[model samples]
Target: MKYIIGLAGIVLVFLLAFVASSDRKRIRYRPLIVMIVLQAILAFVLLNTGVGSFLIGGFASTFEHLLSYAAEGVNFVFGGLANVNEAPFFLNVLLPIVFISALIGILQYIKVLPFIIKYIGLVLSKVNGMGKLESFNAVASAILGQSEVFISVKKQLGAMPRHRLYTLCASAMSTVSMSIVGAYMELIKPEYVVTALVLNLFGGFIIASIINPYEVDPKEDILEIQEEEKQSFFEMLGEYIMDGFKVATTVAAMLIGFVALIAMINGIFSGIFGISFQDLLGYIFAPFAFLMGIPWGDAVQAGSIMATKMVSNEFVAMTTLTNATGLSARAIGIVSVFLVSFANFSSIGIIAGAVKGLHSKQGNEVARFGLKLLYGATLVSVLSATIAGLFM
Candidate 1:
């Protein structure tokens, strides 16, 4: 029964992607079929197998240790703000990003990260039937982040055509930055976070191939990563440390604003319509939730949380998911997988602005296709979650 629903969910996702395809005739099925099979196998291994459990456990434990180390720094700076048992979200969750970001900088400085991103991307390009640059951007986006990933490829920013640029941005929105992975694990199950990260990587390509099909001319598929200006080790370390803090504070600010606004809107809707705004959104998104193998009884609540991620951001939705009651564990797992990407409305502007800062004309091109970009990215999340639902 679960298999039937999961297969139907896959069909529904593909059909939706097919309907929006810019060039349905040009869509390649061979690579898509290969990737879909890969997604399922990977999902099964990650969710059900012993080796998968060991890997996820190690990954989660490593992040846990990293967060503990980060907490020492937080304690030194703001020791008395909260008791050990009652740490604030900003301190407990957001500040650890600073440490992880610094670690990424160290890896970047030593060139290890670039080496890994490059070779893995080369291997993925062979399977995904895309250009080296697109595959690199997808991998780099997962590690470096959406905005920072563009800086790595800034040399080709101006030269990329609209279709290729859409693919680039789609990958950025489909995957989460590694810096925030620990933060997400804190809000949901660590295993689900790991599963979503792997699934979304391939899912990004699968949906992009369908919705924005095009051939990459090998001659034009050159990948020239923009090298960062050389800085002394301490100089680089300080810079990353500050960058991490800025990200932490920025997320904290968004949480404050988005959470309050949602509360206000929910209040107004409840006052007038006897239904909270999220409940209204739940009704609209419930079918997608149901189609993703969430049981019909749980779909409405699951859909509301999914809608929250799309409209506000994943943090807000994850927080809601944590507080939500009456959802079965399976429903929670499926929804947790669904909320792991940067597929919200705000990301369109972020990706566009990131490109615009690099090259004005190319940024404008990103903005023009911004909605389509989000559409493809959201489908990527749905496809990944549906694939995950099969094994769960």
Candidate 2:
């Protein structure tokens, strides 16, 4: 029965994207259908089978273990203040990005990560029938993160057309950074995070192909990414370490403001209207939640989390999910998958600013389509969640 509903959800999501497609005649249903089937198969294997367990679960455990090493660094500096159970949220959750970012730098310096990204993306381009640049950007976004991914392709940013640029940003907005994957595992099930990462890769392409359909001219299909400026090993390591610290602190600041503001808004709503703000948003989003295979009884609560993710950010929504009660395990799994991306209000500005800093004109172009970018990425998250529902 759940599988039936899950199948219906996939159809509904595709229908929604099709309804908004720029050119129905130009829509490549073959790739769309292929990816949808692939999403379902991947979700099923990762969530249900032993192979999935060894892949997703093993990765999560290994990642969590890696994060423990970060804790040692945290303990070194802050002593008892870094113990997660006793430490503040930023201390335990956000600070570890510094270590992870350093590791990313080391991998890049050794040229190991680029080879993997290049090959995987080349393979995906064949399946998605998109340009190599698009495929590479999607995979790079997953690995390097949203803003950082743009730097990987900065040389081409000024030259690429708007439609291709949108696809790149959409991929960035749909996938979470590896640096924060551990923080996500701290909030939701690690397997769901891992699966969402995989599913969103295709989901971003599926939606972008429909909404921003444009053929990449053979002349513009170049995949020449600009390498970062040369630096000594320690010099590069120092830069990434500081960059990671900036990320951690920025996130901490945003959480402070957004979380507090949400509390205040909820207080006002409850005081005057006898309901919290999220509850009201939930009511608005409940039908969609139901269509995603959430039980009707839990739909409102799940919808609230969904609304929170769109209005604010995934971390805020995941925090809410952590404290939520009475939701079915299936609901938890589906919603966890849903909240695993950067498909929120704040990400639009983040992506735009990153581009603007590199190329002001191109950045302005990104801002012009910012809302639409969020729309496509949100659909990417919906597609992933719906497929996850099938396996759950």
Candidate 3:
């Protein structure tokens, strides 16, 4: 009954969104419909199959142990606060963001990440018709943020076609920042992180390809990334650590400011509704969370996180999701995937601001493509959840 409602609602939402779309000619339902069907199959396996149920048990346990390993990292970094009974908010939460940024830098220096990029680029090239460098940067951005990943491909950005440039921005918006990956790994599941990486990589390729489908040239992108031109392994790793520090600081600052702003806005809404802002968030997004396979008992609480994520940032949502009580592990998995991207309203301004700042010449062009990117990211995240939900 629940999944029935979810499927119906998803169909309705898609149809309604489609109707509202002024450019009906460009709507290609192929990927969208395929994703929907996949979501249904996923829901069925989770709900009905004993095999699926057992598999979830394995994944859930493995996820628990993986989190424990991550917790060790947290504990090592912040000793006394490591007590499981009372996790330190700053050490466990903020510091992990700092740590993962450093780790990404470390991985990149070791050339471990480059190999991953090569394989990822190959897959994207074959699957989505993207060039090797474009796909490499997209995959790298999964491990690096917008500015940092740009470093990996800084030279290429200036010369890339307008369509590819937009794709880069869109992919950045659609994926998680590497700095927070460790925290999210502990919050959700290792399998979940791995799955998101896979989906983000796939989504970057597929969605970008859909937005800019020109097979006109088979040549590699004119822009070449030059991360290895001057630095040796140790030097590069140090640079990555420094880069991570810069990124972590920037993100921490953004989160602090953004969180305060959200509280202020929610407070304004709170006065109108005569309920606390959190309560209002819980009231509204609960139904959608319910459709995404969150247990009814935890739906409202989990919905609050989802709503916060949609309105503000996924980091806050993940923080709320990790901290929220009275939720089943399966439900957590579902919500984690649902909250796994830059889908909220805040991202609109972020993209608009960033794109406009850099591409002032095509600022209007950037604005024109903004909503499509948003819609595409939303579809990708939700569709990834549905695929992952089946595994749950």
Best by lDDT: 1
TM-scores, all models, native as reference: 0.99, 0.97, 0.74
Question: Any runs in candidate 2 off by more than 4 Å, and if so which?
Answer: 82-87
From the highest lDDT down, the ranking of the candidates is 1, 2, 3
Q: How do the residues 115-205 of candidate 1 rate in per-residue lDDT, one tens digit apiece?
A: 9999999999999999999999999999999899999999998888889999999999999999999999999999999999999999999
lDDT of 2 by residue, 64-118 (tens): 8889999899879988654456657787888899999999989999998899899
lDDT of each: 0.94, 0.91, 0.64
Which portions of model 1 miss their true places by more than 4 Å?
A: none
lDDT of 3 by residue, 297-386 (tens): 887887788778876777777877777877888778777877777766667666666555655544456567777767767666765664
For candidate 1, the 10 contiguous residues with the lowest summed lDDT are 80-89
**Candidate 3: residue 201 lDDT (0-100):** 55
Superposition TM-score, candidate 2 onto the true structure: 0.97
Report RMSD for candidate 3. 4.8
**Which candidate number maximizes TM-score?**
1
Any runs in candidate 3 off by more than 4 Å, and if so which? 1-6, 9-85, 129-134, 204-216, 219-223, 281-287, 294-300, 326-330, 345-372
